[model samples]
Target chain A: MTERFERELMRGSLDLMVLSVLADGANYGYLIQKRVRDAGGDMIKLQAGTLYPLLHRLEADGVIKSKWDHSTGRKRKWYELTPAGRRRIRDQALQWDKYAACIQRILTPALAALPAK
Target chain B: MTERFERELMRGSLDLMVLSVLADGANYGYLIQKRVRDAGGDMIKLQAGTLYPLLHRLEADGVIKSKWDHSTGRKRKWYELTPAGRRRIRDQALQWDKYAACIQRILTPALAALPAK
Candidate 1:
């Protein structure tokens, strides 16, 4: 796997990615991981170990709240975004956009100077 | 402190904030902590306990490489961004912008609908 993809996936920014997914509605940990993998295509795959810690962190921060559910005849934590969490999702999304644009501007010249494919 | 500021300062995303400061040049941990506080203009102050782990993680990820320097007769770990580190910094800055923008767009309406302050 390319370093870019690995760096992005491993950097633990997955909290925002997971929050984006949960923004739609509630989801269990396994399903959230699956959704990130599916959404990111083959380029990014989130591991369970990373996902759970992030979920707990988000919950601890009160950005996202969770409750135990027995939907599958086994207990699982179902997470959903709270109003605060929703606001955060929006704020973080905006921050990411501006950040991406600045980086793109910086990279454009470098990319242009690269040898042709 | 407002939840917005606290939330931003916490959640351990201090990594990026630190990287942004170090982008100028190599700096020791204590100086970095001081710089972030000074740069943030009292809005954000990075604690040493939180700062060290983030520095270590960044070093571990190879986004930043560090060396111990003896200055003022005391040893300190000084960190500088690597080429790969620079690239990741740029990428992350971009991602944060995009995330922030989308959030701002969503919040505009909500802010507008709020009663006048």
Candidate 2:
């Protein structure tokens, strides 16, 4: 896929990706976006507009918490997963595994079924 | 977890969950919410306030397309994944698997490491 297309697709799945990244340590918005892009290779990148809204929403939902940090010369909002957030990422990961397996089952056709009955 | 807490956690992961749910077939908002709750086994439920915004955002992003259906007595918005969305869910699923594996690595400790060298 083109980088643009990949970016858009990535936007749809940003929350889980963000939580997973923050699972490592606290990070500010730009750094998180950069990490996702770097980690995703050339396939995905996140726009600030999309990323900020998701970060704000996650904070509002209490999955992740943010605080202003002034250690970096200029103040920046840094985010980290709350205890609730950590558990949430774990639960969502489990759910995603089950859901993906179910979808694969539906999508996969038995080889025997390929021939006319 | 309480149903309420599960619902909130589910909110954080709703987009991927929604696309996975819709992969089965097109469905209206209420039915989709019901299916998620039923499939999730009391672990997840979607609220309209949250669901509507997500649906609208997905529509805006061209991941899922929606239409108003009037056949069910009341007008309800129904959604289905676009081809782009299908590809997106697939990519995101693959990325999530890798991300999960990495996190698990960070979390797991070598048994020998428990004792100081």
Candidate 3:
């Protein structure tokens, strides 16, 4: 990725991406990181430093809820989307679609102006 | 668009979007804003307050150049992508494609996991 695009991509959308992982089900931090990394084919890495703070902010905002899980013989904090978070992810996904479509339209006006094939 | 998505979208991408407008040809500030607005179908608004500073930054970064136009009996500043700007846009567009594709994979792992139809 270009340096500018990489910098801007991280600055903008990390939170929503993390929330998306949690949308599937409750997940611990390590797993959450892995899930996002694997899902993006490692193109987008969510470091612990970035992930934890965002998770905290989302929890504090009541978008997600977390609880300790000792089922694996070790303490882990598992997180899941709250009702608000589910709603938030749904809304964010829609907005992303709209925004992306708009950008695509702007970027390819010549193509957009063409009659549908 | 959701507020978070809008805020993040502007934070991350206004530069490239502007660069894209200039990528087509040199244009004055008003026309730059108009092209972007019209391109996005008004979903993405680039207020003058946000656009001029970004244009100046790109200029300072040497990605774009500007000069006064007086052929119409009024002074106007026209901006165009420098050679560096063209290369930058090309690189940025490729990065955006990769990053967006990565995000799509992460966002819809379920669909991605499905076998080819």
Candidate 4:
């Protein structure tokens, strides 16, 4: 809204989105970026600078595991969720729902109470 | 959720929530705290330490204005929206809706594709 996407608002959510991308199947960095962009439309864009560090952190946290594949002509590091990551997606998704509902509870009435334009 | 409130998620939102509180009418620190807490149910709690600084920043930004009132036998600083604040509420509320919807767009299908519990 402020000429830039609200990156601060997106901070806590990046992990969950990345995990969700892997939920369907393994993906390298670029494809995960594409899935989020496609799903989010203009609202989300995962720049490579932001995405790689996040992937490293998730892998370091043991939620994801990676393996390099050279069977195809091009080499790629593909990531998949660990069992723990599956549990996290389930947990974080529930938490995201609760947080969204909390904001709505305050926001809906606040919008209604606003003065006419 | 974590044992603690997701303060990271609350970071960018505190400004909007404080402005929304002032949308109804002027309110002093304690009343604003009560209103946000009640509206957010168990999900939000605005401690004085966090609330006061945010109020001062909003005042500095010129989106909100404050007055010291002594009519009720005790001095209290009451805050209300400025004309700019009204515009901010409208704009921020719309942005918030867009952001929420974006998350839902990605999250709903992600949830559906997850393995059954």
Number of clashes found in candidate 3 = 0
Order of models, best DockQ first: 4, 3, 2, 1
Show where candidate 2 strays beyond 4 Å. A1-12, A110-117, B1-117
* Candidate 1 structure quality by residue, lDDT tens digits, B8-64: 433433566677666777888999888766654434556888889888988888889
DockQ of each: 0.08, 0.09, 0.38, 0.58
Task: Output the number of the TM-score-best candidate.
Answer: 4
Instruction: Give one digit per residue, the lDDT tens place, for model 3 in A67-102.
Output: 998888888999987778877766666677777777
The CAPRI classification for model 2 reads as: incorrect
TM-score of chain B of each: 0.87, 0.78, 0.85, 0.93
Give per-residue lDDT, candidate 4, residue B88: 85
**Model 3 chain A: which ten-residue window has the lowest total lDDT?**
A108-117
Instruction: Give TM per candidate.
Output: 0.52, 0.49, 0.85, 0.89
Q: What share of the true interface contacts does candidate 4 keep?
A: 0.53
Instruction: Summarize candidate 4's per-residue lDDT along A22-43 as a digit string, tens digits.
Output: 9888999988999988877766
lDDT of 3 by residue, B1-117 (tens): 365567677665777788887766678899999988887764677789988898899999999999998888878999987778777766666676777787776667532332333
Q: Going through the candidates in order, what fraction of the true interface contacts does each contain?
A: 0.00, 0.00, 0.44, 0.53
Q: Which docking category, incorrect, acceptable, medium or high, applies to candidate 3?
A: acceptable
Stretches off by above 4 angstroms in model 4 are: A1-5, A72-74, B1-5, B71-74
Displacement of the residue B23 alpha carbon in candidate 2, Å? 14
List residue ranges in candidate 1 displaced over 4 A.
A8-12, A115-117, B1-117
First chain of model 1: TM-score? Answer: 0.88
